[model samples]
Target: MFLTHGMNESGELVSVADVKSGHTNLHCPFCSEKLIARKGAIKEHHFAHAGETCMESKSTIQQTGLPFYDIATGIGKSDIKLLDKFQRYDNVWLSQKQAETAMYLTQGGLLEPSPNKPEKYQLTRLGRDLVKHHDSLLQKKIILPEATLQEQLFPARLAMLQYHDEMNGTQAARFYQLRLQALLNQHLYVLKIHLQQGSTCFPLIKVGITSRSELALRISEIKRDLQQHGEVLSIEIAGLYRHFGSLERLIHKRFRASQFVIGSHTEYFHAIETAHDLSLLNLEALGKRTVEGAYCRTTYREHAHKVRVGQRKAKLLNNTHLGRPAKNAENLLTDHPDIVEAFHASLSLRKANTKTGKAINTVRKVYAALKESGNT
Candidate 1:
């Protein structure tokens, strides 16, 4: 007899759809014998035992302690109708007959009271999963012998368990786990904020790690501390990685040259100077390890071009410097004549201060001196 489900080396149930039409590393869930995948064009896909089938594979037994089987057999037509109706609507007010069926399903952990309204009902996670995989469940039932209803129904439970196991192995799943290990145990956050230094307002990028659960509260604390230095124009989250402290360290190391101190904090970097780091962050977000591909190179080029264009616009509109702050008026006027020209062209200082990039104090002083000396 052909089986629709087989167990892999991990002891997780796998469907015939998961493998190709060849001898697979799959064992019969009932007899623990090697199985062959049959995926011919004419017939339905299934798994057959490589050797003679065992007695258990041929006969049907009343299997207990299987949630999927119990749920599938226990629910009546009315219960299924109610579940389908709830799936279509966000919240449902069941009729008296439907309500009776829903009450039974609720006790069986399929339905729950809606969060928004206590009187209304909603499908639980298990109910949603059943609804989502309804067709697949029916297919499994159709392939199995009529007597082996338990075998047919139990595959859904096994498949769901396998899915849960796979998800637990993912990076996202590891992120949510509160582990005692030091590595990959904190959230890495890239924060962008405009820092006002004298007459200059420039964008400062902060790369740091935190173990806190409430990120909003942490951001609020940061805003409060930074408010004394600047107006705290906007505190935007540029990048976020759960349990990525090592990556945070790598980012800090990459842009160490651009690092600057603001009060007691030292994780800050000049936004324009370290704009290339954006590409790295973008790649990491996309789950790419290497920047060797044409796509990655294009991403780098795009970021560089955007930084250059932003620098030019910042200088023109706000007289903001790009790389670093100028120490003296001679250097400010000599290096960036365009910035001085913009201020002398009657650009409002308030408007200039609104933009963020680099130092603007020296540019302001140079503009004032030039205006007073009638050198404009």
Candidate 2:
């Protein structure tokens, strides 16, 4: 998950991207140690503790106390009873935030506090119905027989063979390995948000990914950020994927020119289009193309390219320094369609052992030479 906020040496909340290597010392709010700002191009920028343990992981669970699940459980019990039951499974100590969360649950009608006891509570009818529905879902039984050890060990290979009848031996093995990786790396989500109608001068679009459990908290954080600029009407779960890191990097690379850096943190690509265009960014569309393929196979490639180019052109024209024309200046050559495309292609190739670093350096050298010659 990306770190939206971190404490700098001055004890001020700052974005991870703003933390410079030597000058700007940042710390994890949870551990209070030097924060590791991972700025890899293929991964989202996030802050982490160098080696020390982060209390945020433990403290968050303590503070929230499984509120979603607790609210879902029919609460025909006293507050003491509920607390005892929760403590038995979760932890011995409940934070003040967890207690407040329980009170809020009552206010939300998920619980009904007794007037007599004050501490006692009962589940509202709606809450009871929800509990029943959840239980029924859990009660569902799978008819498939239990798997043998051999079958369990080779489940992916079997699944690959079952799904890809035309696969050769080598192809089936490769597919199975990829499928296994995808299964092991679960819950990579691509989330999106659009500004509510009539909230701001122009509707804003936000896209991001999180491989964390506290998605609700993340959404709230983003909502709070967006609310500062405009009234947010809704935040939606755009897509969920398995093996999503590569896909996310691909999208970010594709829309690099269109990225909107709010508060110096870059993650959102400004989607300047009608609601219909935003509608196209759904689960089906994200999952349509091959996970490893760039632009061409993607459903939104054309749209994304158009937006990226438009944003780059607009930026170049708007910024006086960049827009200034010199007879022999070759700086604008970097923005040539071929060069820009190649740059993005190089970004995609920057994985594992690859000569991408050399290629990118060569491109940079060409740009430098051009600019130096123009100056001469």
Backbone atom clashes (below 3 Å) for every candidate: 1, 0
* Model 1 residue pairs with clashes: 318-352
Which lDDT tens digits does candidate 1 get at residues 1-376? Answer: 2465677888665656557678999997667899999876445467888999766655421211232321343234455667879889875665786766666566556778888887878888767655555534433212112212222223333343334336444221121111112223446678888877678888889887665644797789788978877777778887775544334444565578898766656678998887665554452422311222111111232456678899999999999889666456556567767666667676665555444233566456766767765775
TM per prediction: 0.29, 0.28
- Residue by residue across 1-376, what tens digits does model 2's lDDT show? 3443456666555655345433236766556777677665465566666776566534432222211211222222344354344323433344685565455445545456656655655555544444444345442221111111111223322332333333232233333333333322334454556665363443445555444544687688788877776677677775555333323333444456677666544666665642344353343423332234111122342465676677678878885333334433354454443543444454332331143334554455444554466632
How many angstroms is residue 367 displaced in model 2 relative to the true structure, after the best TM-score fit?
A: 63
Candidate 1 TM-score, C-alpha based: 0.29
- Runs of candidate 1 exceeding 4 Å displacement: 1-180, 281-376
lDDT of 2: 0.45
Which 10 consecutive residues of model 1 have the lowest summed lDDT? 289-298
Q: What is the C-alpha lDDT of each candidate?
A: 0.57, 0.45
How far off is residue 42 in model 2, in Å? Answer: 16
For each of the candidates, the C-alpha root-mean-square deviation to the true structure, in angstroms, is: 23.2, 27.5
